[model samples]
Target: MTELRHRGPAETDLQAADDFRGLDKDGAPDGDAHSDSEAKGDTGLPDVPVPPDDTPQVLNKALSGLSSRWKNWWVRGILTLAMISFFFFIIYLGPMVLMMIVLCVQIKCFQEIITIGYSVYHSYHLPWFRTLSWYFLLCVNYFFYGETVTDYFFTLVQREEPLRILSKYHRFISFALYLTGFCMFVLSLVKKHYRLQFYMFGWTHVTLLIVVTQSHLIIHNLFEGMIWFIVPISCVICNDIMAYMFGFFFGRTPLIKLSPKKTWEGFVGGFFSTVVFGILLSYVMAGYRYFVCPVEFNSDSNSFTVDCQPSELFQLQEYPLPAVLQSLTGWATVHMYPFQIHSIALSAFASIVGPFGGFFASGFKRAFKIKDFANTIPGHGGIMDRFDCQYLMATFVNVYIASFIRGPNPSKVIQQLLALRLDQQLQIFNSLKAHLTERGLLPANEVAA
Candidate 1:
């Protein structure tokens, strides 16, 4: 509650503002330059000073001044912490529940992405359309992640030995959820102002978003521990910060045509900085040597270990090794060059993809010809503006790791958790699941087995 309140006037419920069209105070046409107050009736209310449609770059030179770099870093810090904390909490909370919460955030974000353009390019009872479309997008987002969630549920059910009977019944279960959702999309067509474009395009984005984001989480969880799940999120936020820090402090070179306020100096600075920090983090975690053993490779036999205790188990003391080891594990080493190599690889991919997502959002704003996604944040723009990099980066990380390397799984985790009782051991599984839930890990409901 304190955290909610601390956000202040900048903290209007974006869900509430989803339908908002950002009208001016006189309640007149945004394009109309004149007002009735000038000619005749003057109300007691003071006129709200609307910023000009043609805003000059560096709207506040003082704000954007080198001295103001600290201010930019400050805002960046808050946003970075917010994104990190939110990602950390959500990833463990329970995948279905985290996704549902993401559904609402996505609605706000996707709506702002479209409406920033709407605000500048077109006009009507836009507030109504914006609001209606927001709920419509909410449904679309709900359907998108809901599809994943529902599919995941059936996938779980279908995996069971008993439920394997439903294997032939897969289509009956899987397709049904989306079919029902598609019908809901059809029902929304009653709002004549809404074109199928909104529903189709909107659903497309939400679906891609879930696939991309979920893959990122799964990949990170595979190799590194929970902290690496924030890799993409941290990179995106750091990109914003170091870019701001460099742009505000030493912004001499403009990078490209998309965002002129952004500088090359800032972009490179943030990119390398994030990689440095991320690799450092990876190295630090490596010190604890979380995984007890390495994936065994038999050089002489050219075969893999048959740890058929379960192929799922990552570690087995019984697995043989020659004096010349295949890989390193709990026997910790600084191993900076190799670890840094991995971090750089991951961060470089993210840095490029992250900014592309931002440019995508910026171009989106241009298509709408709007200034900011929405005035949800005073210095920042909208939730989408903030999360755009994160959205794209998550997808990128997922694809990258999936294409390159496979990470550890829970059976291996279970092997490690064996230090505890079978009952206590299962709590480790609970922790893994907490990643996808909403309650944000409520101490395991009294540590049930």
Candidate 2:
């Protein structure tokens, strides 16, 4: 009996030992297998996260995000409008106040430029002193000699009043300018691996940016002849509205890879609508006080502005044509176009390049993997981000017109028949631009008279 019991217990112990070893060997391998399955994406689950016929909330979530973004846009727009209103209030009720406001806005704009540059090409170090000096130079060049610089360009091709003097001083002036510029470049290399070229480029861009933005605004205000500011702003707000509506409904094909949301359909639709509205708006404004003929002369000698007698004959000191062309300013055409080519080129540029400016900014955002430029606006980003395209658009439009069209380039038939002076012709050219930019905008006359 004792022998049989001992044998039975020994058999039981062997069975238990085998079971323990088997588990030890299988545990690690099983774990390894599970990990491998995970790595291989073998979820052993359904292909779709939710059924193809899932609840609306799945899609609703995406829409909800979009709506939230839109909501912020509205809030920002209202605030911006309110701020603009106050600015106008001061402009009319307080011209002095307008000066301060413009200065502040200009400075903030400069800050944005520097900040953006630093962000993108972070490798460069632009000292504060350089930036400040650049700003000072820009201010002097733009504000003090705004009209003079413009005249210089428009009349550059004209026979010089002092050709002999220019010839006499040409070499000396060239050497002086070259020496000064060279010194600046050499000084730029003073810092460790200093980037003088970039420094100059940055400064030049800043100067041009400020000049273009402010000068155009000033000229626009002058052209509109309005102390009431709503005229220009109407275009901006209307454009944003039209762009959004059109883009939402017809944004089928992506306008660009950087801004996938923007579509060709929206761009074309929005632009057409804006143009149609602008024409109507300009027509309505034609009868307003600000829309009066430039020759109306303010009649008041104490008027702050000079008699901006619209040039006749593309007339010059040497070729002083009859004053008959003066009547054509606002009386004949919408704006002035000294030459047709200049006007058309400007329009084409603003339409294409302007949009690309926005695209360029979008590319930058995508590179950084960010949604917006800043949280300042709900749907839009910062003022700089949102208006960067417009800034370039407005400037280029003006430059293109002033440079090419505001001259005596038109065939004699068109000039004599139309009796349109170069300046008046250019204005007509500008009218097209105005038409594009001023979709929902009120005309100067409507705001005033």
Candidate 3:
């Protein structure tokens, strides 16, 4: 009896030790075997979602014979070529069309992002949320485009009494409209859903900041010169393409945790390729009056025109090579447009820093467990996906111009002077004439007049 009792207690002690170690009585894992494998496989990051097959039936049928991987490649390639072709067509259509396209794209991108918020928060049934979001969009657009119209089309605004009045009170009107939306939002807030409603309120404003504000800057860049808009944008596109090609073929090492597929090899290749592309693209565009000239509104024609003498930056100038480069290349001087040097700066930013915008969008989508912002574009995702980097580039170009490139615009000053009362205009004219005469710049006869 004593021997049996000792063995029983000893066995109980062993059983308790096994339980402490998370093992069953049989000396195996206590839980599901698959759960152990899952713990082993946990990466502390979300799995990258596979893109859905949203291609058209016709294209789908054509690609049906191929494997899924090859089919995706072909679909992306064809759509990419088509988008590029359409882009060229719009550029040919002129600035007005381009501005309209930008507006449309802004609206579409806003919708895609807002729709995602709706899905994530289950706010479809929420009162006044969607309406207020769009109201805010309208209010912001009015404020931005209103300022643009006043700045660029001031002559037209002056001729129309209503537009003139609106231009003068644009800011006040924008604020009033936004205030009305705010009041409505407060009224719409529910007791149980207060937190979610506030979350969505923040989401809407951030979306506006991202979409509308950057787009406004893009329009400003366009007005400076189409080159300001196009070159930066093309640099981003070129970098995107080159990086993808290099990564697809040569990438072995990962570059970032946010985007697993990105690689250092692709990043380096894209940088060099984009720099060369920017230089050549700038060379071609610099030679053209249409591409280099600032967009202006002609009062007589009542339409926009881009016709100005090529700026010195566009003209070819001889630059002396550094001693190191001179000896290596057997060249004393190199003839190139000054703008090409600027292009190197733009291209470097586009290639090196621009990808972060895309990475940010990636993180956002991952947080929401979404594959893409929307299925608006087959094989490419949404308009936001394509233009995320472009928006960042636009802001950079705008700041660059204001800081380094923009000078006193004589014509703009003249337009502002013309908009003043007759007496005020005369006062300014007299002041300028007096200053110029003192400096011996005004002719003797003209100064007397």
Candidate 4:
């Protein structure tokens, strides 16, 4: 009776379970299951776990025989030349293209930095972090570019009713948008991840400040003249190349602990090279009206124009040499554009202080234990790596122009007048007419009319 009970329903149910799992009562897979697992080679990772490098196959084949160090050098050198060629192409295309390139670079750089921040605190799985970061970027860009459009292309904005309204209330709208993002971030904070969320929030803001603000300044420099944009940028690039050349061969004494590869030899060589380069480049660019003239909008033609009388700075001038230089050169005076003198300051800063920006970036990478920001560029690391110094140089150039070069912009003043109500415009005109009349600058007939 006991044997019958054991062999009845209980034994049948156990057999059914084993059959469903494709295993016998001994808990071993059948022949089919074993063969399938074997065929799959279950290594617990994808076949190609990491993506292949996107380097050109021709270059890779050509460089396959070289040592790793030499290969890296050749790759970087070739790519640098390619980038310069592309840059020249864009410049030929026009300022609009250059501005577009700057905008694209700014977006890429922001992406790289924000990605690093995300990875750093990815363990917490913070919600709305990326969304909020991008939201803030859009808000900041809207505020800045809106101001630029309103200032430079006032006629275009004034003609479009919606744009005119938006231009009038741009700042308020930007603030409101930012406040919404801020509130979203505050609400997304979780109890356990409070510190991490705020850290990322601060991280996002700092990245925006560094990337967005400086790039806007670059556009501002571009509007002033192509020379202002080109000279400073070229100086930074030239200094970087010259310094690298000097350091690579003669880098015996280290310049800074943050970047051990940097050498004092490179620093000095780059400074003199950059200063000379700046002067020569500025001289050449100053002679060309297209390069020297401020970019302006034409309401009549509905296009941008760079046709203006050359400013005194762009004209040839003779200045007496200092006693020390006069004695050295045996000349009382030298002919040069005044803008060349300003180039000295621009180049000096690019070579001297611009490198510290790279060092700061180096320190940042070290803190995060990263070799480079990203692998976007095979030998150059990333766009941000190349531009770390350029942004700093842009800030310095903008400030230099503001402090010494720029005065009140008459076009901007006129634009402001045009944006005002007719009555307000008439009031300003009357006030100006009275003031000029008092100074005997206004004709009696014009004043009466």
Itemize residue pairs with steric clashes in candidate 4: none
Model 4 error, position 303 (Å)? 1.1
Error of 2 at 164 (Å): 22
Q: When superposed on Cα atoms, how far off is each prediction in RMSD?
A: 16.8, 22.6, 11.1, 14.2
Name the regions of candidate 4 deviating beyond 4 angstroms: 1-54, 327-330, 440-449
lDDT by residue (tens digit), candidate 1, 349-380: 66666788788777655433455666565456
For model 3, what is the alpha-carbon lDDT of residue 132? 87
Per-residue alpha-carbon lDDT of candidate 2 for residues 17-37, written as tens digits (9 for 90 to 100): 332233222344333454453
Worst 10 residues of 1 by lDDT: 306-315
Candidate 1: stretches off by over 4 Å: 1-104, 114-228, 287-340, 407-449
Which portions of model 3 miss their true places by more than 4 Å?
1-52, 437-449
**Ranking 2 against 4 by TM-score, winner:** 4
Q: How many backbone overlaps does candidate 2 show?
A: 16
| CA lDDT of each prediction against the hidden true structure | 0.50, 0.45, 0.84, 0.84
Report the lDDT tens digits of candidate 3 across residue range 174-253: 99999998999999987655655677799899999999999999999998889998899999999999998888788998
Clashes of 3: 0
